[model samples]
Target: MYGIDVITLVSYDQVQHTDEGMLSLSYWTIVGAYTVRGEKNDTGTMVDAVLYDIPSRKMLFRAPGTSRIKGSSTLVNLSEQLRTDSLNGFHLAADNLVTNLQLELDRFRKKVKAMPESYAIEHQPGYTGGGSLEARYALTLLVIGGFALWSSRRKEGFRDKF
Candidate 1:
């Protein structure tokens, strides 16, 4: 919405390690010759992500997060456990990526504003002309008037709740 031409790039990938074997277990109970099968898992997952400002060619952020998941021995399904763990890891990593991107965007705007005009001397995205704030406000007022006229008769209250 601002005057600047903003370009954004994002990418992500997932990595899984099934060779690690069961990561960590919840609990185990043993008495004599009997033992309870606790939650078990054999795979670890992580998410790697990156985002940048294409126009400025500045590296915005990079994030990686590990998924914490446990499979139950009672379930007797290693594949299911791996799937659940991977999904959790992805979700966690996505959160990190989004948060970092937002922060970097704010930083980018401030950094651009503080720099001198010479900083953008070459290699710029195409121009994007737009009407000023006054024009936009006038258009908004026009639409509001049209809506008020169309919504209710002279004697009726406004259609809007407030």
Candidate 2:
């Protein structure tokens, strides 16, 4: 009942640690020495959205988005930091996916207009397709109608005078 024409499927794929590095700090004094160590993690996420024709089961297009996040965390909080970074990466990638989807939609519209035979375009029952008249065309029609009305009135005035 919703009149759905196309279906979109989204997935998050290719998630991995794109980069890793070691972080270390050391301080030495006359009495003793202290050292700290940590790990730097870089996570990457890819989001893909595919649009398909429900009836034909044909793929219209695929839009892909990617994001990378780098952060340093102590060994005790490594897992928590990585989880936060992964969530952030997905959010950023999803945002980019939306932008890509819009661009793909515009491209698809232009393609359909350029080559109408490739796909079928239809409107649901009780829905009528319409086009708008340009401002100049409407203004010209209004001027012509007004002049015709004025001329008719002027001619009637001359007939009454005679």
Candidate 3:
């Protein structure tokens, strides 16, 4: 909505192994399983999608989906896994992409809305220019650490009293 007219699915990459149609599921399950054990996971499907925001000229999100099914020692099992994986991957990637993009957009909106209204550069009031900001920050950290250590020691005796 940020002056965006066209939102395009720039690229859709689906791994060749995903089974989209059960039409060939039976054929492949039998004929394809002969060498399933000999091969290593040639059946699983994976899809990578990139969304392009045309108005902003930015790539919004990339979602990748793949089969989560486990246990495939034989060709039959592997074929089944692949069939499931193909569908699983597409769904997982799409769902993840949408959720991730929503979170990202929310974060972006919060940041933009809360941006400081004005900006000005000015020197620190009591700075004699003896050391840089980095040095001062380091010293501040050391002081805080020392104080914490001192306070923690005081509580050591208090715990024994209870």
For all predicted structures, in order, the TM-scores are 0.45, 0.62, 0.38
lDDT of each: 0.55, 0.78, 0.55
- Model 1 lDDT, full chain set: 0.55
Error of 2 at 161 (Å): 85
lDDT of 1 by residue, 117-162 (tens): 6246443365344534577899999999988886666436544444
Best by lDDT: 2
Q: Candidate 1's error at 85, in angstroms?
A: 1.3
The reply for model 3, stretches above 4 Å from the true place, is 1-6, 16-73, 115-162
On residues 1-162, what C-alpha lDDT tens digit does candidate 3 reach at each position? 464443645333455333323233334567645544433343334445556646456664555544443323344465666666556666766666667656766865665467744222244567667555687899999999999999998899789899
Badly placed stretches (over 4 Å) of model 1 are 1-8, 18-75, 118-162
Tens-digit per-residue lDDT, 17-60, candidate 2: 52334343321332211223256678889999999988788999
Residue 26 displacement in candidate 1 (angstroms): 15
Regions of model 2 farther than 4 Å from truth: 1-5, 18-37, 126-162
Screening candidate 2 with a backbone cut-off below 3 angstroms (N, C-alpha, C), the clashing residue pairs are none
TM-score of 1: 0.45
Candidates ranked, most accurate by TM-score first: 2, 1, 3
